[model samples]
Target chain A: MMKIVTRNLITYATLLLAYTLLFRFGLSSLLTAEKWIWVKVIAVIYGAMIFVTAWMTGRRDGKENFLFDAGFRWNLTTGIVWGLVSEGWFLLGLHSNYESIRMIHIPLLIWSGFLVLHFSLFLILKRRTIGGVHKTDIFE
Target chain B: MTTNDTFHEDLLGAWEETYKKGQLTLWIFLSLKEGPKYVTQLQESIALFSKGTIRAEEQSLYRTLRKFYHLKMVDFSSGKGHKGPDRKYYHLTPLGQSLLQSFVERNILLFFEEPLKDLLLS
Candidate 1:
């Protein structure tokens, strides 16, 4: 658990640093001309990173037990972080009167949908009592 | 290498892999049978008891413990760590002890029989 948490903290920190560099250096200007294409690309990349990290963490632990739960938790954490960051960016754009930044909502909406699905699958699997050590549970 | 040597190597490797995988659960139970242990202690005990034959990873041990906890085969209490936060010290429940006892009687003790002992030695 500490290992996973530490790994995730490092990942999130790296991600934040990378995003800051991209935006502060030149990505913000590029976003205007590209009509939020960079934003979409970044969103996709972030989603993939979150998924791969969670999946790897689960596989390392024991997929039969921790896979979906890991994915769910990762998704939940990243989803909130993504939502907050995007909302902040959008609010900043509004204050500065940048029309193109409003499109950030597209990725946020899509991510929220996937997050809901991930959460629902987690709940379903827990209710069904599938996977984990219960796979061979005789007491049940 | 000769074809025969290669084949033998592969076969032995596969057998060892399967054997280790199967024995992990038993070793885990035996480790807990000694006393309640945290994950690191459990890993150390298993390696020591198995004479370095089995070395379980932290994640795998946590996964097994989580399963046991869910199954009510094990219970844990929070205890202070050496320099870190609290740790969960897991101990076998009554059900787990009974199961281990029954398992030893039905399966493990068979190897101690005269014929099986000779076969194993041979």
Candidate 2:
């Protein structure tokens, strides 16, 4: 569990750093006319990073670690971090008078939908297995 | 090999598989009954005490330990490792000990009764 959380935190931190460098360090200015393009690019990168990190964690931990629902927890933590950073970036863009700053909402809304679906799937799976001893439960 | 030999082998394999499934947990508890142990030590103790009938993967053992920890059946504290960082030494809680005692009395002691003993001997 700690390993999963730590890997997630590191992934989020790296993504956050990349966002800050791109937006706060003149990358936004350089791509003034193509602001939407760059924003979409960042959004894609964020999505990809989340997917990759979650996949790697699942692979490393395997189904044995699901006693705590580690995947769901990972998604929840990732959602929180993604939310905060994107909102902060949007605010920075708003104050800096960057065009199409509202474009950030597109990725935010999509990611939020994904999180809802992930959570629903988790609940369904949990309910289905609630009566039986989890395969991972050695005590069973 | 003959068909009869193959069938006999399959029957024994199936029986062993079913028996081994439930035995792992009992063996784990029995191993902890001796004393607190880290993962490797617990694995070795279980294999030794079970006369090599049970073997557990490291990952599965950790998962079981985590579940036991959460259930308050076991607890652990950091202890020195051979050459690396600290290790968690796990011991059974009072709840676990009582449960084990009850299990032995109810299920195990039955095998020692006169009829069962005579049946086994015969």
Once fitted onto the true fold, the runs of candidate 1 whose alpha carbons sit more than 4 angstroms away are A1-27, A32-70, A94-102, A127-140, B1-6, B34-91, B102-122
Candidate 2 Cα misplacement greater than 4 A, ranges: A1-49, A59-67, A92-102, A106-140, B1-3, B36-41, B58-63, B76-89, B105-122
Judged by DockQ cut-offs, is candidate 2 incorrect, acceptable, medium or high?
Answer: acceptable
What TM-score does chain A reach in every model?
0.54, 0.56
Expressed as tens digits, the lDDT of each residue in A20-63 for candidate 1 is 44543344565556657776776577557656665665454444
Q: List the residue pairs that clash in candidate 2.
A: none
Error of 2 at B90 (Å): 3.9
lDDT of 2 by residue, A37-114 (tens): 776776576567657766775565545444445366666666566566557766765334553546567767887898
lDDT for A59 in candidate 2 is 62
lDDT of 1 by residue, B11-77 (tens): 9989988777667778889999999999999999999998998989998788778777777888999
Q: What is the C-alpha DockQ of each candidate?
A: 0.13, 0.27
How much of the true contact map at the interface does candidate 1 reproduce, as a fraction?
0.00
Q: Give the alpha carbon lDDT tens digit for every residue of B33-95 in model 2.
A: 999999999999989997888999887788778777766788999999999999999999998
